[model samples]
Target: MCHAHFEDKYLCRNNRISNIAVPTLKMRSPLTPPSTTSLQQLNLGHGPSPSSLTATMQEAALPSTSETNVHLNLGEKTTVKKAKSRVFLTNTEKYLQDKLVAASIKLSKMKNRFKKLSVNVKAAKQIASNPAVCDILENCTSTRKLLISMQCQEDHKKEKERRFTLQEKIASLSIFKQSPKGYRFLRFFLFCLLSKH
Candidate 1:
């Protein structure tokens, strides 16, 4: 009886060891076995061999039952038509080429205009610096000064308008501050505003 019990225990231990070892043995390496079908699918430098092409043609010629029935039901028959290579350029391609040419012309014109503007600006600066040209410019300086003063007055007017707007905002805020809820709301709003800044 003791020998039978020891044999049962030994069998249980053997089963446990096998359960552990079997999984480790089954856990194969990440490197997989290469497949012949995958290798055949790969496109090497040259086109498919004559035999491969014939095999493909045979496969294509053999229609499925469903496809064959559909063709028959439609009163049509399967005919092997030679696949034609497509020539794709349309009107849009010609339009794009024309647009590209126009853009290049426009870019060249813009470059020329920029060069002309630079030359004119340089000449204007040099003329303004020369004593003879300075005398002529000085004669016109009074009119130019009037123009500058007019511009300054316009700027001042805009500044005053901006200041008035700011003052109105401040006055509105002061009026709101008198109310208890407004004061709390303003404080919360200011806190958020300051945190954002």
Candidate 2:
């Protein structure tokens, strides 16, 4: 019913198919609409126009063709990409240079973080020392707090060991002395775990 809705019927009650001057239509398939040239030849006075019938049946709307999808098929159309070579640390001196540079950057960041945390912890200790909070302080020894204290101690121990390791590495690098400037890099970076007085 939906397919035939577009095509209107206009057969006279007395007229028959053999009596008409128009030739019989050739149907290629039951589903496909008749060819546009054949449909254009038809002139039913009251039916919808041939242009309207062809417009609806033209290939479904498409964004682009296969040729448009390919961008770099031609030499003139294609652009080269930025290329880089992989660098393996084969030279000991080149590897050492990169290692020293990275270690210096990491050392400065570690020192700053350690200093800030120490200041906060010192302020917290002073705050806890207030005489008015003695009753609350006496009752503050919970299992959770004990576990937290143990974790803090372990973290502090690890921090001290890491600082010693850094010092050892810097000391070991003393073998590579510069001919012009001497080992100023070692003196500049070798940090000590100084205790707060």
Candidate 3:
């Protein structure tokens, strides 16, 4: 009876010690084995073999269903595989198919419209830069081709006018330096030369 009591007390102490140690063991190394050495540490490379690693990885990977079967029993005659059953569509299914097709066509048209809209936006931006082009665009509102042609003509006219003005300024500056006194003196000298001639 005394030995039995002592054994129970010893077992209780051991249980208490294990409960305390388990928490510390988990805290110290979460992945480490409770025993001193693991299988990986005991191995020469301190890791699993490549073949085993591949095998374990394959085992861990999700299993896929196999549709093809090659094996056949010798006693049983080889039977030809049955063809797939024909799919019969309900009225609702047919309606849904039609709706989906129409939706896809509408989506394609919308995409084309969006592309055209983007092109138009780019064209509008190009035209908006020049007030002459804008005025021409506003005035020539008959047809797109006519409006574009008129705007182009107006742009060319403005460009020619700008070039002519610049050339005139350059020509005047070339005849005399751009100081008021110098310009007046040059005009007076020209006037005296013209009078003597």
The top-ranked prediction according to TM-score is 3
lDDT of 2 by residue, 1-197 (tens): 12222222333345432233342244234587679777656655557776877765563453346654563354334433222244456689798988999999999999999999999899878877887666665676553344334344444454445333443334334423332133344233432222222
TM-score order of candidates, best first?
A: 3, 2, 1
In candidate 2, stretches whose alpha carbon ends up further than 4 angstroms from where it belongs are: 1-90, 140-197
For candidate 3, the per-residue lDDT at 68 reads 21
For candidate 3, the lDDT comes to 0.52
Give the least accurate 10-residue stretch of model 2, judged by summed lDDT. Answer: 1-10
The C-alpha stretches of model 3 lying farther than 4 A from their native spots are 1-86, 131-197
TM-score of each: 0.26, 0.26, 0.28
In candidate 1, stretches whose alpha carbon ends up further than 4 angstroms from where it belongs are 1-88, 140-197
Model 1 — which ten-residue stretch has the worst lDDT?
188-197
Better of 1 and 2 by TM-score: 2
lDDT tens digits, residues 76-185, model 1?
Answer: 32232222334456799978988999999999999999999799789968866899966765677443544333343343344334222343345435545577576556
The pairs that clash in candidate 2 are none
- For candidate 2, give the lDDT: 0.50
CA lDDT, every model vs. true structure: 0.55, 0.50, 0.52
